[model samples]
Target: MPSQQDDADPVDTSVAHPARRYDYLLGGKDNFEADRESARLIAERMPTIRLVAQENRWFLHRVVRFLAERGIRQFLDIGTGIPTSPNTHQIAQDVDPTARIVYVDNDPLVLAHARALLTGDPLGDTAYLQADLREPRKILDDPQLRQVLDFSEPVGLLLIAVLHFIRDDDDPKQIVDTLVSALPEGSFVAATHVTLEYMSPEQFAAVRARAEHQSAVRSGAELTALFEHPRLQVVEPGAQSVSRWWPDEAPQPRPSIEDVACNGILARVGPRSA
Candidate 1:
């Protein structure tokens, strides 16, 4: 069994956290009243909010399987929420038993559930790190992460439904660039971000007012801009609704972009530009 690393701070149930709120939206039991209240407020504004959460999670599943099928055996998954079943490691290891994964999240509650995440196929490895996404350097430099993932090989960097939590003032693009730069050539990045593009002005205003302090939802273009590094080449279809990212793999009659309100992008890291 892979031991959990990092000292997690005490969970504050009085305040709403993105991870717990996401768990609540996904109908998981790990969330507290504060998370449920926050999710309810958002759902009241966007009736499809629960569907959006479900679709985003399925997107994570598909992307991990996609990368693992392509021969990438190691992954760095940041923003690991409350342990939903068949997590990133579960999906990737299902494709390749030897897949190695490192999960990072700021939620103390997630760390409390780290033992469940740390279990993987005996042939593979999984480690949970309690950390915030805003500090990419700290994550990359962590010794446990370095021990599990080899920087020399292709690594699938997963930023699913988490980057939007990073405020613009925090320089999210720079943070992404820092992590991508650490990857060797042929590594890939898969990210999904919440968007307000599909909402009407009134709906957008309502959601924004409710989410302002917690999330920084961006437009499709803004989400794309975060992967602007010269070495990062976006895969087919550029940025599109998560529901439409790879529709054939998703359920039939895909949900409308207006209903999902999230965008996903898959990019490959190439050799650094001369």
Candidate 2:
């Protein structure tokens, strides 16, 4: 099992956290009333919100497997929500027991559960860091991250279902650039974000107004624009609803984009510009 670096702040259950709320949506018992309340409100606006969460999770599993199959043995999984089975490490290590993974999250509760449940294959390594995505430098510079991941090799950077939590003022583009820039050439970045583009005008306005306190949903175009870096190239299929990213691997009769309302992208990092 891996050790967890503690966050100074105690867990505040009064306010709803995206991670806890996500766990709740996934039918996990690790959430509090506030998280359930927040998810309930979101579900009221979008009846298929739970299915959206499931599809996003499945997307993460598929992307990890894809990266692992392509010889990506190390991963930096940020915004790792509460311990869900078949986690990033589980899927990657399944493909190769030697795969190393580093999980980062701001929530102390996530850290607590992750330390206990996120133990990867003994042949590999796993470490948990309590950190915020807004501070990419801190995550990149963390001693645990450096110890677990080797910069010389390609890494799969997973931002699954978390980027929407970052508000516009947070400069998400710059944050993503800083992290992607630090990776060596051949590294891959995969991200999934909530979007309202598939919704009707009426539902979009209603959900947007109510969900503003929790997330900053971006359309597929805006989400794609976040990876506008000289060394990054979008993978084939470009930006698509999470359910549609790899429909062949997904369950038959895939849900409509309108129900998923989320976009995912995978970009590979090329050699640094001289």
Candidate 3:
């Protein structure tokens, strides 16, 4: 892994960043009062938002494990927040000790603490890149990503809980298409996006008011559009609530779509037409 100190970016603690706020919501301590306060404000509007984060994480774990089970040994996780247990590398390495992972994020704080995310099994390798998802070409061309991942082989691309941060003006679909296009056949894209489909009008309004600056909340159809590129084919279960996507086991009390408030999908890159 490259050293973050060589190109150390300044971190602004005065503002509430989405990654830090998400860390706070996940009960992690690598966040500031600004993040905690922002999380508190959002919680006031959506009481179950914390659970939503947890379920979103659960979805991530399941997808990583599923990919490993399908013989995928390389991973590129974008929008990776603060270091959390059972991270993409951890989960993938658990299945195969030789799995390699590349973690990408724009948060300077996440880069500052990236050393923690590098401690993977001896057989596997882990690396971090301080980059934004909007610049898919740069991320695809990054030296570290090329060093750790072989574009000729199938790689699991994780976009969990990050797409919402990309507004429509950025052309999120094209961004996704660009990333997927760079990967070889059989590579998979697993993503989860915040949705307003399950929320009532009043609840949606409250959430939008709190998160408008943070991200754009889309409906289910809009969220699905991000994965509808010609080169991609939807996997089983298609796009559905994060909690409902291939759960390890059905919850004793099953969570409704409203409880998760997010949609997730795992799709594969298809062969190009002759």
Candidate 4:
């Protein structure tokens, strides 16, 4: 995993950034004209992108709550975007006031906003790390992460809606494997990824071309394969649309597959086979 000099990187507001564009799509005010323009171009092709972003956020909420209820407390959430309401730490700490979270993101703006807004519960703990997800070893070895979490215990490794930004050439699978390898048995890896499987050929091509960040949208099988490391086993409900995965309360009118284009899974690491 290549490491960019986090300190040397400057915030370029002139160019649309993935985190800022996502914040804008989610109706947050931390975006600039460049981000809005980028979002506008993408929304022009798939108008429901905002809805898709919301669905992915909801998935994060549900998954965090589920993991907390299951007694998994420590969280290493990489690619954490701008701090939004009911953020990952908020949801996890709500379930268990002592839950610990380490929020990691490469964007300096995200780091700035997160450090200011992502306060932890008095009973719990939270820390922010400005780093790239590609360097799993660096993240795992960070002193801040070590300070907040106990690697010996079960942890919830969150990769929600972030992996799509990593191109296939980046070896995203190796990144995942490296992160998972550092986690102890009983730890859970939950991830949500954007997919092109549901889109028409023309729509898929158009969205990819307009996307500000290079994306590697995968098929269901390919996405599922990301969690197929020997030490990890995918949990029930497998990989499916976020809205369709264990809904808390059904909407009056259920959302169709077209309503959400992301697939997610919660996989657990267990004892190595004899």
Highest TM-score model number? 2
Error at 76, model 1, angstroms = 0.3
Q: How do the predictions measure up, each by TM-score?
A: 0.96, 0.97, 0.95, 0.93
The residue ranges of model 2 lying beyond 4 angstroms of the native Cα positions read: 1-4
lDDT (Cα, 0-100) at 4 in candidate 3:
55
Task: Rate residue 114 of model 2 by lDDT.
Answer: 92
Question: Which residue pairs collide, candidate 4?
Answer: none
Best by lDDT: 2
Reference-based lDDT, residue 195, model 2: 97
lDDT score of residue 239 within candidate 1: 92
- Tens digits of per-residue lDDT, candidate 4, 161-237, equal 89988888889999998998888999999999987667788887787775535678876678788888999989878
Per lDDT, what order, best first? Answer: 2, 1, 3, 4
Per-residue lDDT of model 2, residues 81-188, tens digit only: 998998999999999999999999999999889978988899999989989999999999988789899999999999998899898999999999999899999999
lDDT of 3 at 148: 89
RMSD of 1: 1.4
Tens digits of per-residue lDDT for model 1, 149-189: 99999999999989998898999999999999999999999
Which of candidates 2 and 4 is the stronger one according to TM-score? 2
TM-score of 3: 0.95
Candidate 4 whole-model C-alpha lDDT, 0 to 1:
0.85
Instruction: Give lDDT: candidate 2, residue 228.
Output: 91
lDDT over C-alpha atoms for residue 76 of model 4: 91
- For residues 1-274, write the lDDT of model 3, one tens digit per residue: 8435336577889889989988999999999998998889888888888989988888898899889999999999999999889799888999999999999989988987787556898888899988999999999998888998998899999998999999889999999989988988899999998887898889988888877877888876787787888889899888889878876553446588887788898999987667
**Please, what is the whole-model Cα lDDT of each candidate in the order they appear?**
0.89, 0.92, 0.87, 0.85
Residue 117 lDDT (model 1): 55
